[model samples]
Each structure stands twice: as structure tokens, then as C-alpha cells.
Target: MTDQSPSEIALESRQAKAARLFSPSAARNRDAIGDLLAGLLPPSARVLEIGSGTGEHAVSVCQRRPDIGWQPSDPDAVSRASQNAWAAEMAPNMRPSLDLDLTRPGWDAGLGGFDALVCLNVIHIAPWAVAEAIAAASRTLIAGDDSLVYLYGPYLEGAATAPSNLDFDRSLKSRNAQWGVRARSDVEALFAAAGWAAPDRHEMPANNLSLVFRRRSPL
Candidate 1:
């Protein structure tokens, strides 16, 4: 057996290509992420995943937990192709990829509401506005009582640690002026302002942290 580079795996299809480009880490982290989700997400939850990158998480979540319905959305057409491919391959409780760009207004016109939402590594890659939009839109999507919003990614801990995150943060800023790792307190504040509250934080293998926020009020 051989491990393939993202470009090597991408040669399979358009969807695979997107997966290679965006979610190259899926093969490594999907299961760990799913473990966290299993505890947070409802048994019969409908999860709307924002920035579904390669759709790797969508497929893993649906396949591992058949009780949940997984919906993936991405703004990039090429990325959506990758997500769609995985959705077809898995054939579990999955929905087609949506053309969702949180930076725009009225983005959820046709998608409807969800019992849960998941976002992995999006906040650090995109502008602050992206995170802001997601926080605002979440209030409308989630169902009542324990409807979860799970965010997984590297973030600043107010204190600081392992030089890797500092380097990663620098790299992010270098790539895009608007992109950079955000503080945990800032993220929690966003949820709080939207009438959501944070649960306990879980540490992952990497410096990434899983921030769980749930809507406290009914829609």
C-alpha cells in the first residue's frame, strides 16, 4: 500500500481534485472529528455543514452514524464536485452539495433549517466576515434544545503554545490579509451575541480545538 499526495489522489475526479486541494487532511482527521460529533449531535439530527471542503466529513459522518442526515455545502463549484462525488460514493444519509457562500446575504434561501451544523477549518482560512455571517445565519438554521454547532480548527488560546500554531497563523496571514487564526474568546463571543452558548472545549490531536455552541432559544 502507498500513501498518495493530494495531487495524486486528485487525478481520480473533479471531486477528488477538490478534496485534494481543500481537505487533504480528511483521511487523517475525519474519524476523530466524528467521535466528537457523535457525542454532540442528536441521533436523528439533520446536519448542515458549512464549507464542506471535500465532503470528506459529510461522508464520514453519514456512514459512521446512519441515524444522522448530512448536508454539505461549499461555494466553490470545483469543491462541490468533490463533495458530490463522495456523497454518491457513500450513499448513506446524504444530501447534494449546496452553493452556499456565507459572505453573501440571504444565503439560506432554499436550504431550509438544520438540527445541527458543522464547520472544520473554515474560520481560519476565510475572512472574519465569514465567521460573522455563519454566527448570524446559525440562529435561523438550528432546531431547539441541544441543536449543536460544531467548529473544528486551530485557534489562539489567549495564552499561546507550541510554535507551530504561531507559524501557522503567520502563514495564514501571509496567504491572505483577511485570513488568520482567531481567538477562542472571540469565537465564543460571536455565539453568545447570537443567543447561543458554548459547551466544554475538547482538545484534538493537533492544536485544533472543537468549540461546541448550541442555540438556547426556539426559532
Candidate 2:
């Protein structure tokens, strides 16, 4: 038997209800994202997914690839609760969502070893420093030539910028000056500075892209 405070019990109840929150976009984009991930990730890999909003993608991707161990994380408490609930219902391989903030210096603290890192529609929602932190952390966490880091979102890529993405970028900037679509060249430069190879860009169903990066050699 265990003892619990009234506040602890109340917190537990709130968390249970929180899990039901859903994201419509997560459902729409999951299948397409999974298909792309299937080709990029190894048959058996430990994958850490950052900014696991509503936990839908974590559950969906893990269900598709049972061999992959999935760690879902987000800084938001509500998102963490939602992820925990989804993991409980759908994914045996999914671990409890961790409190992760990319703006912090030691963002990767306490996370177990992982072969790959996945971030979906996150960089555009946060400041550029967040992306840089991810790059720096990936260099520290992932090792060897086979390690991978995959980023999925809309980006400004030279003259190839779609009109829709341009509009989206404008809307994002309007919301927060620091938040907007990042340049592919800028992202590649960060990865290069961290000693990772240049990213391979894959076009997705929406105007989004999947940027796959790996190390040329162990760092």
C-alpha cells in the first residue's frame, strides 16, 4: 500500500482527463510522416521525438514500427500528459514523455541513449536558437556514421519557396517575431558546424519537408 496527498490525487485525475486532447493536424499528417520515416530510420532503432504535441505522432509512428523504441518529449505539461495517455493506450515501445526545452543548454539531460532524433513542425514554432540547440545536442547524443537526425517542417529554400509556405511564414512571424520558417541553408550550416553531414531533403504531401541528417564520422 502507498500513501498519497489530496493534491497528488487531484493532479492524477487532471492528468487522466488531459490525455484526451487531440490535434486534428496530427491525424492528417501522421501517415505521410510515417511513410517517410519508414525509409529513413533503421529497422531497429531507439528514436527520441521532440515536441510531441498531443502525442499522436509518437503513438502512430511507434505502432507502425514496433521494433523502434520511441521516447516522446515536450516542455508543455498538457502535452506531456496527452503523450502519457496515448502511450498507455497505443504504444508498448513508447516511454513516458520527458520535460524538454530546446532553449536550455543541457536539454538532453537524463535522456537515455538513442540512435536517432525526430522533430516535426517544431523549429518553425520556436526561435532559431532551438534548432541550434537540437543540432548541438544531436552531436553529443548520437554517434557513429549510422546515427540520424530528422527534421520535418516547412522551410525557406532559395527560389523554390512555395507561395503557400511564404504566406505561412508571414503568418508565423505575425504571431511571434522569433518564430517563422527557417532557411534550409541555415539549418545545413548549423549541422555542418556540429560536424554532421548535409541534410537530404524530401518533399512531403503538404508543403512540408523531411530533412535527414547524419554524421560523416563518429564525433
**Residue 89 displacement in candidate 2 (angstroms):** 0.6
Q: Put down candidate 1 lDDT per residue, 1-219, tens digits, no spaces.
A: 224221111111222343434454776788898777876778789889888877777777787788888888887777788788777766458788887877666677766568887898888888788889888778787766868788998888766655788898898888777888888889999989988876568888677788888766555
- The TM-score that candidate 2 achieves is 0.87
Top-TM-score candidate index? 2
lDDT of 1 at 27: 69
Instruction: Estimate, for each residue in 59-101, the C-alpha lDDT of model 2 and write its tens digit.
Output: 7788888998898988778888888988888888899889887
Ten-residue stretch with the least lDDT total in model 2: 5-14
Cα-lDDT of candidate 1: 0.77
Q: Give TM-scores for every candidate, taking all chains together and pairing residue i with residue i.
A: 0.86, 0.87
- TM-score, candidate number 1: 0.86
